[model samples]
Target chain A: MRGAVRALIALGSATAVWLGLLHLLFMADLDDFFGGDSGLRPGAASLAARHVKMWSEPTLKELELKKMRQSNAEWDFMGRTFLVLALANMSLRDPGSADKYVDVIDRIIDETIKIEAEHGVYYFLMPYARERPFMAKSGRSIFVDGEIALMLAARRIVRESDEYATLLEQRLDSMVHQMKDSPVMCSESYPDECWMFCNAVGMAALRMSDVLDGTDHSEFISDWLASIKRNLVDSDTGMLISSFSVDGQAFDGPEGSSIWMVAHCLDLVDPEFARDQYCRARQELGRSVLGFGYAREWPRSWQSPADVDSGPIIPVLEMSAGSSGMAVLGAASFEDREFLLGLMTSLKFAGFPVRRDGELKFCASNQVGDAVLLYAMVQGPVWASVKRRWNEAHVSSVGWVDKSVPVAAAGEL
Target chain B: MRSDFFKLPRIDELLSPRGFLKRAAVLTVVFAVFHVAGLREMTSFLCGMAPMTGGAAKLSALMGLGYVVSYLGFIVIVPILVIASALLLVSSRIWPVKPRV
Candidate 1:
């Protein structure tokens, strides 16, 4: 009895202590992952400083790009795009530091556009993009067009550029024409395929364009929203499916990686519906255990195979690196402070953050991943600007201010 | 004949544990070595770092896996072990373990 009692004591004590103190290892706050009064958090500043340094220093930048290119050339380009975007948003938030960020942004934009012109669209795309030709008259990838447009739009949002205005409009016109031309109003990223991720991004670019140029694509956008309602959502999960054929067949189910940003982009298109999607996704994909929060790639009801985007789901927890990275967008988009805090803490715990000479990088994540984190920390103001523009446009319009209708806010899309 | 980490300890010894302290010290030293050796950078492959070229890719992956495991062990498991041990000591002092039969 004495021996048994001691054994129980040791076990019980250890359990209690671990249960109590294990969370301390991951203690962090939302402020560190978000903008405060100063418009830059410590982690965000370190990350931005590191990227700015990498861009200014060519050899280090090449080495980093080469590693990413070997995996996916898209990621290489995406790293540039995301960083440029983060810088643009940062510039808006931090006017004192705006000039430095704008310089880096312009350099990245010039280099990116030049590289695409030289190497062709295939340079940044995956091998499968070449497997079949695009369905449009011009062999353009929506993946390229959408992101580049957003980069341009974001830059112009910070400080309007005459050069970028033409560039943004040219890209948007072609995309709008192509999307409008399609029977289902979906533009292709891959051959005969349209992704919710890319479409949402394309939509965000459109919304941002309206913010900048006073152009209205409300009819086009609302129609696309109608199409989304009719065809894009998964019935089983009641969340939007990820990809579809140009003719509007569901290609993939609601995915965490896709939905978080989808919900975020929808904030520009429709705030109430965006809120609805976010709440539903929070119900399905979001997980909070003990104190740490994570997101799973698929809802329990959606039977799907793991794909590249899921990024090696942890065995039983079903956490996806891809989804979790994008979940930052969701949490930030909705101002889910508690979830954001928990997720950032989990990131600090798992992301293998290294700080040297005031530079921060997550060792367990690559350039694109780090860029996404930076964007998460500083995403609000850009979207806020878009919404403000949207509200301004609709303030005098009849019946537009009515919040009673879900579709009335952004005009149903 | 054998070393057993999980072996039960007498209540009096647990109150001011030496073995537990020794284990914590070892973990700290090992973590220090890992930190100094720059194993943390190698762990970048855990996310998705690709090796530069042909034959080196496999080798780089192996090194990444090794670094990541050790890094996790050092940061997570070792701390857990040390804390649990400390808790055992604290519990011993609180209850003043009665002599085992």
Candidate 2:
């Protein structure tokens, strides 16, 4: 009996060590999987191939999109938006195969514009978007305007298009008009509800427009940032609240989904402030356990139920697939390699990636999830252009829009 | 024991360090069989984005849950059990529990 008990104890100890060893082994390979620049990144290539393949096969696209649309039409639409932007960035980043990526980007942009036109704006919006009338006269959602503008602007950056160029300026004008009209310089994403994520994207598009065109909105962008600092920040967390009313009242406190990319977007608008937000968000939301890093939807201080944005929170750990996945953007944007690697490991171990014949899809994720991953992988070029422009010159009081320099090289932005 | 080929191992024999390790290895093999039998596809429900459009959706989700549980066992629990049991077996062989406390 004594011998048996002793053996059992020894077995338990060995189990603990064995588990640790397995984790260590898994972690050792994360650099290859998540590192920013490796010579040949098959993961990005495989995922991009899968996305491009979906677009070419309409039936496949419809079937997969139908599944997501059944839950949230916004996802169905956002999936297309993210993929377009990723393809544009991919085109710029991988100039060797730019033609194929550009083809797919054009296809997606055309299809998305058709869908919006045919189905009307509400087709891509959530059901709740119709519950209360939008304050804006045209029944616009900042969500739609922001993403569509970014998509258009991103398309123009890789290669110039006269048609899209005109359309991009119009979208920017409408968004700017709405923001200037609102008390907080925030536009509605869902009727009365305005999202920082949408606003950030909207601002990002505005910034990009200035880059592509010799037009400046730095003062307008600056006022909006000032208003956010004064009215939109969550008192407890000091992070900007995720959503607010059109008139500027808080909807909820900081959320991982909204804040991560918001921080990334802020890098274009305000570098110092964006870094501050990223640091706060990282501290409040990020968690690592047993060598896997994940994020919580809500901080322990502020409580909100899991909705589409939050996804389902795994109870004890407060691990959220939604937040953790978006956190990939935050980590990658800030070059937080350690955290990025940890999250990437969790993704491989749990995301249930299915790779075959050089195409990869995470069985555990939907179209939006995969597109978001693609965005993180190929994000630097356009942002680099915007940052270069911001750093070179301060906003002139007269709103200087320099037109003398050749713009194709990206440095002139 | 030598004469009766049909007799099962006694509790003591099964509980012996080597016996425990053998049992764990056998269990792991069983789990690997289940994993290969195509249970991994069903595990996508764990991501909460599983398709709900067709009648097959719910049935598929139920099957997926089964696959996820089995896969988790195969990847996590089974490995630990096998390694633990092996450790116990080795320790027992190297240092048979002393007679005194």
Please give each candidate's TM-score. 0.89, 0.89
lDDT of 1 by residue, A1-413 (tens): 55345545654666566656665778776666685534788878988999999999999999889888877787888788779878988997899999999999999999999999999989989889989889887888788899999899999988989999999999999999999877778799888888888888899999899879988888889899998888888887778888888888877889997899889888788777888899999989999776778899999988676676776688789888888888987898788888887788778777878899999999878888899888888877777777766676765662344242344644643
> What residue pairs clash in candidate 1, if any at all?
none
Reference contacts preserved by each model: 0.42, 0.44
Error of 1 at A113 (Å): 1.3
Q: Chain A TM-score of each model, in the order shown?
A: 0.93, 0.92
lDDT of model 1 at residue A305?
Answer: 68
Query: RMSDs, each prediction?
Result: 4.2, 4.5
lDDT of 1 by residue, B1-101 (tens): 56865788666444334655565577667777766877667665655565344567667767667666666666655655566666666766787756657
- For each candidate, the alpha-carbon lDDT, in order, equals 0.80, 0.80
Question: What TM-score would you report for chain A in candidate 2?
Answer: 0.92
Candidate 1 chain A has its poorest 10 consecutive residues by lDDT at A398-407
Q: DockQ for candidate 1, please give it.
A: 0.36
TM-score attained by model 2: 0.89
